[model samples]
Target: MASSADDVFTAICGGTFVYPAVMHEQYQDIRVTNRDGVTLGSIREITYGHAISRMVSRATEEITRIDHTSRTIESRFKPNALSTFNEFIGSDLLRDPSEVVGQNL
Candidate 1:
């Protein structure tokens, strides 16, 4: 069995969210936190031109889902922008379980 921490990581591996502010364009971001709300680190689709392209390409594939297609912000808004690039990707990542097996004993 996987520990709670493991579960959390697996859940956020390739998750999706709707950003209404960004024209409702689907996006993905990695946010790691503990029970105390201490964030470990986070990586959003936003990528930089100076950044590694190989890493960005691989990450792009991992974050977006194949089912519900979403426009990658990088491809749409700033395709030629001399800045970081953002990809669209999402999956079942870091979501609360549908049901709890048990309660406080």
Candidate 2:
């Protein structure tokens, strides 16, 4: 599952063709050090948002945009997701870029 702030990349109704390689060398430090848990992306999206008008209404907890050519990514996290994130990661370290501050989570 390739997940981003706004999208969870899945094909054929979310079935995976291959493992995500959680044990890859480059990701070793992340998995090895943060044994307890992990949260991805910048949380600056936690408090900001934009409204889009549509004929069919829907609800969302987050929003994200990526510009490959410009090499930029943006995300917005709503109250529920933010609160949940803070609860999971703790409220004390609710900074812009959410990160692993300690070893073994």
Candidate 3:
């Protein structure tokens, strides 16, 4: 294990509603060991990059879905929904998780 990448990925996939609980459960099973059967490190780096990439992909999908839904709603009924969707798509908080994953091995 290298970093808490798996936790981050789980959080993203589960969405805002369930990520917190799933992350806590996953964290409990994380561990590290060496060749001699000795505990060397306890970081969660085993799937960091994969997790980050998954998060980025999922975020992109979510943004796309929101954009489509907003456009449909605006064209058919409500205009105010566009503003909310735009705000969510434009927010700086939803960043690519891959950038946070370390590259050095």
Candidate 4:
């Protein structure tokens, strides 16, 4: 449903590369052009593979934080009585699906 954030920003500003979510209902924006002529094999290399994993994580996190119902990300606008202070919490994928793949590799 969501597009990967790989081509988002520069390296200094941490980038994310989201993976495909076949079950999602929304359609990703079409980007058919090959800007740098990079092939699928090149993108599947270790560096890019890692990037994709990280992007998928960011997309999930952003969704949770942006979704008003989720309340996963702490917000400063929240009533000052909920807790001592709002905290920024990043996603932690425990026992990830890719964990097995990494171990085997």
Which candidate number would show the highest TM-score if scored against the true structure?
2
**Tens digit per residue, CA lDDT, model 2, 27-66:** 1111111211122332221121212211111112222454
Clashing pairs in 4: 16-55, 17-55, 18-56
Q: Across residues 1-96, which tens digit of lDDT does each residue of candidate 3 receive?
A: 222334433333332222211232222122222221111221221211122222211110011111223322111111122222111111224434
lDDT of every model, 2 decimals: 0.25, 0.24, 0.22, 0.23
User: What's model 2's lDDT at 45?
Assistant: 18
All-Cα superposition RMSD per candidate: 16.7, 16.0, 18.8, 17.5
Clashing pairs in 3: 1-45, 2-45
Q: All candidates' TM-scores? A: 0.17, 0.21, 0.14, 0.15
Q: Model 2 misses residue 22 by how many Å?
A: 23
TM-score for candidate 3, residues paired by index = 0.14
Comparing 1 and 2 on lDDT, the stronger one = 1
lDDT of 1 by residue, 1-105 (tens): 112322333344244333222211111232222221112222233221112231111121122222324522211122223332333222334423222111110
Clashes of each: 15, 1, 2, 3
Query: Which of 1 and 3 is ahead in lDDT?
Result: 1
